[model samples]
Structures are given as C-alpha cells and as structure tokens.
Target: METVRVNLGSRSYDIALTHGATANLGAFVRAALPKTSSVLVVGDSNSWPHAESIQATLTRAGLRAGSAVVPAGEASKCLERLAGLYDALYELAADRSTAVVAVGGGVIGDLAGFAAATYNRGLPLVMVPTTLLSMVDSSVGGKTGINHPKGKNLIGSFHQPAGVWIDLAFLNTLPAREFISGLAEVVKYGVILDAAFFAYLESNSHAVRTRDPGALLRVVTRSCRLKADVVEQDEYERTGLRAVLNYGHTFAHAFETCGGYGTLLHGEAVSIGMECAAQLARKLGLIGDEFVSRQTKLLDALGLPTAPPTRWPADDLIAVMRRDKKAVGGQMRFILPTRLGEVKLFDDVPEPLVRTVLESAVSR
Candidate 1:
C-alpha cells in the first residue's frame, strides 16, 4: 500500500492506495473515526456490491452500519437524489457522530459527500472511489455538491473527506469507456503541471491502456500527489493556485450542461474540452500547432474523444459557459494552457473568439 497525505493542519487526511484495500475498510474506518459508532454507506447501483461488503465488514467490527443505493450516472447528481439521501440518512438515524462512506465514482462521492457535509451541520466522510476519475480528482478535494438545473456543480461546497481509500481492484470491473474517460483528467494533470509526467504517459501509453498494475500505481500516485500539493496551497480556491486544477473544466462543464447532463460522461466532455482549450490557446498564439497535435495524438491513442459531439449546438454551449462558477462579474474566466506543464487564468475572453473555437470543435 502507498500513502499520500493532504496536509491541512487539523483537517489533514491520508489517501491509501492498494490492491484490495476495500476489504480492509473496516479497520481503516475505525482508525479514521475512532469515536464513531454508526456509518451511512452511500453507493450507486453499480457499486452496491462493494458497499454491501463494506457494510458487512463494519457490522462484524461491531459498528452500526446501514447502506442506501442510488441509481448510477450523471443524472443522479441532482437536488432530488440529494433530498432522497438526506431522507435515507434520517431513516438510518444518522447523527453528527456518524461517518459517511462513499462508494463508487465521482457522482457517488459528490452526492454522499454533500449529504455528509450538510447532515446535522456535518459528518465525517470517507471516500472509496471505484473509478479512475474519482481517485485522481473528486475524492480528494473535499468539493461536494449536487447539480442544479442551470449548470454543473453550481450548487456545492468544499467539505474535505476524513479519509480516501483507493483500491485498484475496483477497476477490474470498470467499464472500458468509463476507464478511458478517466484518462482525460490524468492527462489534465500532466498538461497543467508536469511535463515530465505527460512524457511518461506518452511513453507508457500501452501499459496504462492495459491497466498494468505498476503503471496504474504510478499514474494514480503521481496524480494524487500533484493534486494534493495544489489543494494544500489553496484549500478553498482563495488563491489562484487551485484554479489551475480547472485547466479544462470551464469548457467541460458547459458541454455537460448543454448535453442535458446525461448526453456524455463528465470525462468524455473533459477530453473534448481540453482539446478546445488547446485549440483556443493555439488561436491566441499561446502555444504552437505542435502542442495541439501532441495532445490530440495522446488523447486519440487513449481512446478519448477530442472533438465535441456533432449533436451539441455551439451557441447553446457558449451560453452555458457564461454561468460557469469561475465566471466573475458576468465575464468568463478560463484556465488556458500556455504550454504543456503550464497554464494561466485568462478572464473576459471575447465572445466572438469563444464562439469561433466552439463552432470549430462542434463542426469538426
């Protein structure tokens, strides 16, 4: 097992990465919340088996544990499902001393984390991420929320988890498309922060595609460590440091919103979003065509989409972008890449230029 610590003074926690770590979740939960006697295991339908096993383990450990399974997918990240979770927790008689164990991908983590953050003021959150996207991004940040009708992640909070347990074994059952979707975020980390990591991914593409254990360990560990360093510097997005983490998210979120939330997976939108950002950067002369080509090649090799789905309208997508959380004073803000391993927050980009890029991405 490998451990990465998020040093946040009193709020600090550890991300434990290992094969079959979920089997030992009972002990891990006990160590993280020694005073807690009850746990609310929240999982999606696809991940309920793991949640069931976890509940059984906790029961054997003499802890009062109950579980509620929600439908899987992006549509579930809404106010209705969130309310359902609150009701379920109340039925479970969960109190402030209760800990929430989130099992599954980003959707489950965000929904359960939000439930834990708001229930009776707050409750401890333990993340058991089953997808690559959650393991690398959402599970560690403490950013939790349900989506509103208007935008993606429009309603959310920064409530950090007490512990994040990542088990490689979960990926064995992960769908191939979902697995490919996750590589987008992994590529994001390399694009915005580590050129060497990006090169490493390029060289080891075959190993990563095959889910070789050693490559996965390195990819996940490095991704978490990079994100933790950023979170440590700007836990709540006060400084612009954390903004870099949204390298392609501004465009991605808009794509998701325009797609009616279920049209494409989050990471699929992100893969295309990153491509758009790179193209926009090229148009602005922030980077050369070579940079865009390299990114496109890598994404293509990873089986990720680099172009917006033709069905989505570019103008409607731009409207959605205006409501992005990063928008300030009704003006847009984007974390644009200046080059691989580097990016900067660019605000108030002209609407015409934005439309031009969106049109190209959509029409291509």
Candidate 2:
C-alpha cells in the first residue's frame, strides 16, 4: 500500500492507496482512532455487502461493529436520508468514541461524514471509498454533506476524516459508466493544477479505461496527492487557493440541481461544466481555440458528456449558479482555466456571456 498525508497539523490524516488493503482496514481505523470502542459502518445498496464484510473485519479486531445500508443513488443524498443516518446512530447509541466508517461511494461518504460530524457533537470518521470518484476526490477532502433542492452540497460541513482508507480492489466491481464518470474529476486535477498529469492521462487513456492496475494506481495516487496539497493549504476553504479545485463545479452543481440530482451523475455534469467553462475562457481571450479542442477531445475520449444532456433553460441554470456558495453579491464565481496546468477564479463574468454559453450547451 502507498500512503499520502493530508498535513493539517493536528487534524492531519493519511490516505492509503492499494489494490487489496481491505483486510487491514480494521488495523487502519484502529490506529487512526485508537480510543473508539465501536464503529457504525455506513454504505448504500450497491456497497452493502462490502460494508458487512468490513463490519466483520472490525468485529474480529475486537471492536463492536454494526452496519447500515441506504438506497443507492444521488437522490439518497438529502435531508430524509441524513435524518435516517442520525436515527441509525441514535439507535446504535453512538458517541464521540464510536467511529463512523463510510464504506461506499461519494453519496454514502458525504451522508455518513455529515452524520459523524453532527451526531453526538461529532464522531471520528474513517472513509472506505468503493468508487473511483470517491477514492480520488471526496474521500480525502473531509467535505461532508447532502444535497438541497436549490443547489448541490448546499448543506454540508468540513469535518476532515480521522483517516481515508482506500483499496483499489473496490474498483474491481465498479460499473463501466460509473468508472468513466470518475475520470472527469481526474481530468479536472490536470486541467486545474498539473499539466503533466493531464499529459500522462492523455497518453494512458486506453490503459485507464481498461482498468490496468498500474495505471489506476498512478491515477488515484496522483489525484489524491494533488487534492491533499490543496487541502493542506486551505483546510476550510478560507483561502481562494482551494477554489481552484472547483474548476467545473459551479456549472456542474447547477446541472445536477436542474436535473433533480439523479439525472446527471456528478461526473457527467462536471464534464459538461468544464466544456462550458472552457468555452467561456476562450470567449474571454484567456485561451485559444486549440486549448478548448484539447479539453473537449479528452472528455470525449473518456466517453463523458461534453454538452448538457438535456435542454435546461440557460436563465434557470444561471439562477442556480447565482445561489451557489461561491457566488458574491448575486454573481457566480467561476474557476476558469487560463492554461493546461492552471486555473483562476473569475467573479466578474457578464450575465450575457454566461447566458450565451449556457444557451450554447443545449444538447441539440
């Protein structure tokens, strides 16, 4: 197993990336929260089996462990599901000493993390991400929350995990579409922070899509390191430096909200969002035509959507963007790429230009 550290002083944690590390999960969590006497293993429908297995592993390691499963889908990330988690913890008689081990994808990780952060005045969290998206992105950030009707992740908190335990073995059963969906965030890391990672991806797209083990290790490890670097600098997003990680999220969240959460998977929405953002950047003369084509081709190669999947109203999308947390004075802030390896946040974009880009994104 390879380890990367999110150096947050006292709140620091380790991210373990390996192909078959599930057997040691108990030891990992035990080391992270040694005082914990019990664990609440949370997962969704698709990942329930794995959650149960993890429970057994923890129990064998001499800690009391129980498991709960939520319906698997984006819709589950809501107030109702969150309340259900709270009830589960209550029934479990959990306390600060009981670690909440999240055992599925982003939805479960976010929901369980939020529950761990709020229940009994907060509990330790150990993430066992079972999806590519969660492994490289959500699993490390300590960003926990559910979705709101108005926008994505509108209700959330920053309760960094005690540790993030990742095993690429979890990806063995991941669906093809879901696997493809994760590449969007992987691509985002390249577009926003590292050009070489982007080049490496472009060169290894075939291997990545084929699930080559070596390629996946590089993909997950590099993505985690890049994200950790950002989180280390701005743990609570106080500095605008962390916003660079939101390169396509403003447009992506609006797409997700307008789709009523499940219509477009977060990765699909982000792919489309990056397309619009790239177009907007070109319109502002920050990049040339070649750059836009390069980005679009990469997404296309990854089999992710490059345009809105449906005809969401441009005005409505903009309205949702305005309500985004990063917006200032009713204006949305966009993380626009200025080059292959760098992005910048822009808060002064004109509504007309935004409208034009949104209008241009219509699938047909």
Candidate 3:
C-alpha cells in the first residue's frame, strides 16, 4: 500500500492507496476510530456491491451499519435527496462519534461528506472512494456538498474526513467510458504541476486505458501527491495557490450547468475544458501552439472528447462561468497555464476573449 499524508494541521489525514484495500476497509476504519459504532453507509446504486461488502464487514466487526443508497447520477446531488439522507441518518440515530463512510464516486462522496459535516453538528467521515476520479481527487479534499441548480459545488463546506481509503480494484468494474473520463482529472494533475508526470502520461496513456495496475498506481499516487501538497499549503482555498487545481474546472462547470448535469460526466467535460483552456493559453501567447496540440492529441488518444459537440452559445456559458464561486465579483478568474508544468490564475482575461475561446472550442 502507498500512503500519502494530507497535512492540514489539526485536520490532517492519510490516504491509503492499493489494489485490494477494499477487502480490509473494516480494519482501516476501525483503526482510524476505535469507538465508531453506528455508521451511515451512503452510496449510489451502481456501487451497491462494494457497499454491501463494506456493510457486511462492518457488521462482522461489531459495528452497526445502516445504509442509504441513492440512484446513480448527478441528479442525486440535490437538496431534496440530501434532506432525505439527513432524515435517514436521524432515523439511524447517528451521533458525533458515529462515522459516515461514502462508498461511491464523487457525487456520493460530496453528498455523504456534507451529511457528515452538518449532521449532529458534524461527525467523523471515512471516505472509501470507488472511482478513479474520487480516489485521486474529491475523496480527500474535505470540500463536500451537493449542487444547487444554479451551480456546481456552490453549497459546500470544508469538512475534512478522518481518513480516506483508496482501493484501485474497484476501478476494474467501472465502464470503459467512465474510466476514460477519469483520466481527465488525472491529466489535470500533470498539466498544473508536474512536467515529468505529463510526459509519463504521454508514454503510458495506452497502459492506463488498458487498466495496467502499475500504471494505475503511478498515476493515482502522483495525482494524490500533488493534491495533498496543495491541500497542505491551502486547505481552505483562501490563499489562491490551491486554485490552480481548478485548471479545467472553470470551463467544466459551465459545460455541466449549461448542458444539464448528466449530459456530460464531470471528467468528460474537464477533458474538453482542459483542451479549451490550453487553446485560450495559446491564443493569449502564454503557451506555445505545440502545448495545445499535445493536450488535444492525448485526450483524443484516450477516447475522450476534446471539444464540446454543439456550438453552445458562448454567452450562456459565460453567464454560468460568472456565477462560479471562484469568480471575483462579475470578473472571471481562470487558472491558465503558462507552461506545461505551471499554471497561474489570471483575473484580467477579457470576457470577449473567453467567449471567443468558448466559441472556437465548440465550433471546432
């Protein structure tokens, strides 16, 4: 097992990554909180098999596990669904000492973690991320919440989990499209921080698509390391250094909101978003044209969409982008790459230029 520590002062925790970590989840969660008794195991229906195994393990270990399974989709992240989960937790009588284990992808993690954060004035959370995207990103950051129709992650809190358990084996059951979609976030790690990691992906993109264990471990660990390092520096996202993690998310949220949530998987949107951001960078002369081609080619090779299909009205996307929490007042702030390995937030990016890039990305 490869363990990376997310140093967040009092909120510090470790992320354990391995192939078969799910089998030993009971032990890990118990070790993290010996007194944890009643746990609300929140998962999506697609993840029920693993959730069942986890519930059974907890039961065998003398912990009472109550489950709340939601339908699998972005629609599950709603106020009504979240309220229902709170009602379930209340019925189960979950206390502050009780642990909440989120056993699915990013949607479940965000919803369940928010429940843990707000229920009974906050309880301990143990996230067992089953998706590649969640394992490498969402499951650790403590940024938990459901989406409002207005925007993604607009209603969230910074509630750090007790620990995160990453089992790469769960990814084997993921659909090929979903797995490929996940590579978008993994690629974001390389784009924002590590030039060498980007090169490695260039070389090993095939192995990743094939689900090679060695390649999986390397990419997951490297992505986690980059996230952990940034979280350590700015846990609350107040310093703006951590905003680099949103390299492609600015465009991604617009895609999700404008097209409706389920129309594009978050990672799929991000794949296109990254390419769009790269194009904008090139347009601004911040990066060379070669960088844009390299990004698009890798995304194309991975069977992920590199651009939005329809010429979505740039004005509509701009409207959604303006509503993003990262935006300052009405001005748009973006994490734009200056080079392959480094990205910086640019607040002065003209709205006309942004609209032009959005128009270009969709038209192409």
Candidate 4:
C-alpha cells in the first residue's frame, strides 16, 4: 500500500492506494472515522453491484450503511440529480454525524462530497474512489461540485474528505476508454511537475495501459503523492501551486462545453486539451516542435484523442474559454507548458495567438 497525506491543517486527510484494499476498508474507516455507526453510500448505478460488497464489509464491522444510486454518466452531475439525492438522504434519515461514502468515479465523488458538505450543515465525507481519475485527482483535492449548463464544475464547493480509500482492483472492470481517460490525468501529474515521471510514462505507456499491477501501482502512487504535496501546501488553491494542476483544463473545459456533455469524457477532453496546450506552447515559442510531437505521439499511443473535434468553430472555442473560471478581467488565463514537466500560468497570452492555436487544434 502507498499512502499520501493532504495536510490541510484542520481538514487534513490521507489517501491510501493499494491493489486489493477494499477488503480492509471497514477496519481502516473504523480506525480513522470518529463514528462509523452510520454511513450513506452514494454511488452510480453501474457501481451498485460492487458497492454491495462494500456495504457488506461496512455492515459486518458494525456500520449501518444506506445507499443512494444515481444514473451513471456526466448528465447526472446536476442540480436536479443532486436534489434527488438530497431527497434520498432525507428518506434515509441521515444526520450531521452520518458519514458519506462515495464509491464510484469523479461524478459520484463530486456529488456525494457536495451532499455531505451541505447535509445538516456538514457530515464526515469518506471517499472510496473506484476510478483512476478519481483516485489520482478528484478524490484528493477538496474541490467538489456538479457541472452547470454554463460550465463544468461551476456549481461546487471545496469540501475535503475525511479519508480516501483507493483500491486498484476496480480498474480491472473499467472499460478501455475509461482506463485511457484515467491515464490522461496520470499524465497530467507528470506534465505539470515531474518530468522524469513523464519520461517513465513515455517508456512504459503500453505496460501501464495493459494494467500491469506494478506499473499501475507506481503511476497511481506517484500521481497521488505529487497531488497531495501540492494540495497540502495550498489547500484552498490560495497559492498558485495548486492551480498548475489545471495545466490543460482551460482548453479542456472549452472542448467539453462546445462538444456537448457526454459527447466527450472529461479525460478525453483533457487528452485533446493537453495537445492544444502543447501546440499553444510551441506557437508562443515556450517550447519546440519536438516536445509537442513527443507528447502528442505518446497520447495517441494510449488511444486517447489528441485533437479537439473539427466541428467546433475557432470562435466558439475562444468564446467558451473566455468564460472559464481562470479568466480575469475578460482576458483568459492559460496554463501553459514551458517545458516537458514545468507548466506556468500566463495571463498575458494574446487573443490572436489563442485563436490561432484553437483553430489549429480543432482543425486537426
């Protein structure tokens, strides 16, 4: 097992990554949670079957578990769905002391975290992340929310979890596309901070995709450690260190928004967005053609999309980017890669250059 700590002072927590850790979840929660008598297990419909095992584990350990099942997909992460979950929680007779366990992907984590944050003011939120993207990113940082029609994760709050339980066995059931999407986030960890890790991915992409236990464990542990290190230093994203995690998200949000929700998965948008960012970096002379080609090639090899849909107009892409949370005073803030693993924030990025990059990216 690999453990990473997010030191947020009062809200600090630990993220544990292991191949077959689910079996020990009850014991871990009992040791970590102040009161484990009751927990609301929130998961997507697709995750309910596996969640049954988790429910049993919790029950056998003296924890009474109530479950709320939401439809699986991005569309469910909305106010309406949240409202439904709120009703379910009410029917379940949950209280402030009830611990909420989110046992699916990013969508479940975001919704359940938000519910726990708002339920009777607040509850102890426990995360049992079953997806790669959730394990490395969404499950660690306190950032939780559902998407609005206007933008992704627009309506949310920063509610950190009490603990995060990651079990690699769930990856065995993840579809190929979902698995590759998770790798996009894994790559993001490298692109933003660890160049050596990026090189490792470049060399071992195939093995990682094939679900080699050793390779997946190494990648997940490293990614979680890096993210935890940054979040501990800047828990509320007060410092810009945490913002670097959005290296490719500016373009990614635009891609997903324009493409329509469900048309492109978050990871898929990110994969293409990273390519767009790389192109922008090269156009700005921040990096060279060789670097862009290298990143794009590795992304392609992973079976992830490396280009935005050509159907979107450059103007639309630019328009959506302007609405991103990172935008300032009507100017867009971009997370650009200055080198292979070093990303920087650039508020001075000109519109023309941005437009040019978007045109080239979507056209490709």
Leading candidate by lDDT: 2
RMSD of each: 1.1, 1.1, 1.0, 1.2
Off by over 4 Å in 2: none
Per-candidate Cα lDDT values, in order, are 0.90, 0.90, 0.89, 0.86
How many clashing residue pairs appear in each of the predictions shown? 0, 0, 0, 0
Identify the superior model by lDDT, candidate 2 or candidate 3: 2
After superposing candidate 1 on the true structure, give the runs of residues whose Cα lies further than 4 Å from its correct spot. none
| Candidate 1 local lDDT, 286-314, one digit each (tens) | 99999999999999989999887765776
Model 2 clashing residue pairs (backbone): none
Greater lDDT among 1 and 3 belongs to 1
Q: How well does each candidate superpose onto the true structure, as a TM-score? A: 0.98, 0.98, 0.98, 0.97
- Which has the higher lDDT value, candidate number 2 or candidate number 4? 2
Candidate 4 lDDT at 92 equals 76
What digit string (tens of lDDT, one per residue) describes model 4 on residues 1-364?
A: 7788778788888887878768788887887786657888898987887688898888888888888899998898899989887887788788765788999999999999998888788888889888888888899988889898888889888899999999999999988888899889888888888999999999998999899999989999899899988888887787777889998899899988988888888999999889888888888999999988888888887788997655688788889888888787778888898887798989898889888877777567
List clashing residue pairs in candidate 1: none
For 308-356, candidate 3 gives per-residue lDDT tens digits of: 8677788899998888899989888889999988999998997888888
lDDT against true structure, model 4? 0.86
